[model samples]
Target: MKRFFIGLTIVIILGLFVGTGYFLYQKSEEPPIIYETDTPFKTDIIKKTIATGSIVPRKEVALKSQVSGVVEKLYLEEGAQVKIGDLVAKIKIIPNVVALNNAQAQLQTAKINFDNSEKELKRQKELFDEKVISEFDYNQFLLDFNLRKQEVEAAENNLELIKEGSSQKTGNVSNLVRSTVNGMILDIPVKEGTFIIESNTFNEGTSIASVADMSEMIFEGKVDESEVGKINVGMDLSLSVGAIEGVIFNAKLEFISPKGESDEGAIKFDIKAAVDLKEEYFLRAGYSATADIILQKASDVLAIKESNLIFEGDDIFVEVRTGEQQFERRQVKTGLSDGINIQIAEGLTEEEVIKKL
Candidate 1:
């Protein structure tokens, strides 16, 4: 019994030694992951959103003809600078045959009556002066002669208007269409022989030309409904044109549409920005541009890489390096964030080291 007990004890002791050796060997084979700390640097960070849009002129004017006629001449072409009262085009008369013939017949009848009445009036006046005619007869003859003369004049004026565009008294209405304002001719829609209709009270007729004051330019863009409420008139804006890259122009918010429209489930508000163009930069009408309105700015602030920030519920935390092998999660207060970088309002200073990745 003593020999059996001693043998069992030896076997148990050897099994324990082998188990301990296997545990130590497994731990040594595992790989280790290490992280490094970075020295904090001073930098400026701003949060902004990007929007895409096009540039448009501050004002646009469309010129239209005033009478229905064939175009006789077009003095100004596209991109022509013109002043007020400059003649743009002329219209040649295309008479109505039936109306012209009627006017001519009326004129001949009026002339016959006017001549005969004048002769009778002269004889009657002489007889009255010689005491051989009554005063009533002379007055009647004088009235009849004046009526005939008026009819003759009316017919003659009508005939001249049908043959030409206007009589001597009604000067030429077809010879000129003077510009109403000073501007550059942006477009000329009519050729020399193109027919045009007058813009009247009932309808918007054909457009003859388009003129605009190019000196005044504006930026038209849209902002998401979420950001629209934050903007107001007179706010400064930074703009970049798609065609003119690497340059940014400054502007001010001039208009905000009170209404909003839904686009692809997102509500958007239209905004107009008035560009303050320098004498060197002449902004052409309808150039595409992107505008950035600064909502907030800080003169001097301590900021950090945006990726370093972590959130738990509503609170923000950052991993602060404590020692070569130790780190702790720290709570921090934050201010303005410009998307790429964020301002560290509390729990950080310029000399503190941080982990970037």
Candidate 2:
């Protein structure tokens, strides 16, 4: 039995040795890893970000009218060029009863006083001519009579104005709301006979005119908060206004709001740019535009594929081909990269081949 047990142990040990040898042979049969290599040469690299927005006039003025009266006539409509002092709208004033009554009472009192002053002046003049009164007294009487006559005229003018918007001296009952600034009529808020209220200290009345200097336009758009910080005033920009097709207008960043507005749960900063309208395209106010701001640029620069670069502690490296079938790890100095390519400032030459892995 002892002999049989010893023989069984020998067979088991022999099987274990064969298995170990087979495992070693399988490990030695594996091949060495060969990293791929790529040659670095001259290439143009450009990095840009695309932003979507609408083209808007750089300087758009909101025109509003203030008057409480019926719009008698709107002489102009949208797309009409108007000059300063040009008639825009005529307001028909429906005299308020309270105002009219007050004006009439004031005029009646002034007329009565005028008659009394005129009789007194006539008596004083007769006395002075007959040498019954001194020249100084007659002069005083004449002054009083002139003052009353002026008062009567002023009172009448006021009365007429209260009954009608304009007096005879002022020309007509129509209140001519003229254009204060020279520009195009962008909008007409009121139609003929449309009642409007004059802008008063208490309240902002109806808007009669929407005018702006159409020639001077501005681009109004928003930039993401992340990008807004990189942009500064006077940065160059290229814009494409959606309204006028196939047109590119040059612009400059003018204003950036310090405060951010929360939009759809994301913070966004408002930006205003002044577009240089060299092309003379009809850029309507509030037209959508997208702007490409060229923040920084470098030309004829030494660059390489960005993906080829590997990073270690305080060091950048890449695998370059030292021979036809050999690759060695090489340290490199990189500069501005447009993502796809990086500026190879150092550690690699134009003729060197870099291993992608």
Candidate 3:
């Protein structure tokens, strides 16, 4: 019975060892890697770089106050369309006590002078009529009286201007702010009763409103200094606004700054392009936008994905599938690359399949 048990144990241990060996052998085998392949095709390749900027009006005008006063009334609100000579806002001048008193005193002194001159003129006239004075002498006194009368009127008008924003002689024109250019009002920083200082030698004054012509808009953006040298004025641009989606606007490059400005550690050159605005769509000023500038382009050329090309020292080469699961390295000449697909200039045929890796 002991011998039969020993034989049974040996058989069981051998069976277990055989099953483990079979599982290990199966695990060692793996499926062969079937390399994916792609063929060259005819397509248009455009090499471009992106620039960040905002859309702004080509002709923007900031209307400022000419006199120190309060914003008494506003004729137009933000986004209101206006034409040349249109009323925008009205300023009610707040007179200074010293200036008003001086003007009043001047007017009073002119009146006193006029009264004395009138009395003198009457005496002279009576003397001339009675043949007691020459006609020339009477005429001279009359001229002096008239001159004094004119001075009094002028002083009174000056006093009125100092006390009030508008005078009878100047009418309401001085206080009424008018638009100098035909445009839509973009902003009105001041409201009713807001005190504002006039533009003088000391200050720039207060800006009442900013108006711009929407018909003529431009994309003002900046590009990195490295890319700026490749771009020149008059190149075409395709722009996309962040607020307005799925639409691309066409623009023509008009200006490029000769100087570079440092922004966030990167030197950038300011660029401007005239946007061709569509009548149906209104582009508000300062809309954030991205511009894609085409540096080079090739149409209907043989091209392949740039990933398939392997860099070997200074030359570029790709693996072409010669047979099943097989490839041969082929050196190829390249042309314009849009950073994704590159143009295959030479040493490769469209019929040949290239390995993706």
In terms of TM-score, the best-performing candidate is 3
- The Cα error of candidate 2 at residue 140, in Å, is 3.3
Clash pairs detected, candidate 1: 46-338, 47-338, 47-339
TM-score attained by model 3 = 0.94
Give me the displacement of residue 186 in model 2, in angstroms. Answer: 1.6
Better of 1 and 3 by lDDT: 3
Give the whole-model CA lDDT for all candidates, comma-separated. Answer: 0.81, 0.79, 0.91
RMSD per prediction, one decimal? 6.6, 7.0, 1.9
Query: By summed lDDT, which 10 consecutive residues of candidate 1 come out lowest?
Result: 40-49
Two-way TM-score contest, 1 vs 2, winner: 1
* Tens digits of per-residue lDDT for model 3, 1-357: 999999999999999999999999999999788999999999999988899999999999988877889999999899999999899998998888899889989999999999999999988888999999999988999999999999998898888876666668657556667899999999999999999988878999899999999899999999999899899999999999998899999999999999999999999999999998877788989899999998888999999999899997999999998899999999999998988899999989889999997
The C-alpha stretches of model 2 lying farther than 4 A from their native spots are 1-54, 62-66, 170-174, 200-203, 223-229, 244-246, 257-270, 320-328, 347-357
- For model 3, the superposed segments whose C-alpha errors exceed 4 Å read 1-7, 29-31, 170-172
In TM-score terms, candidate 2 sits at: 0.75
Q: For model 3, which pairs clash?
A: none
lDDT against true structure, model 2: 0.79
**Per-residue accuracy of model 1 over 88-164 as CA lDDT, tens digit each:** 88776566679878988999999999999999999999999998988998899999999999999889998887666
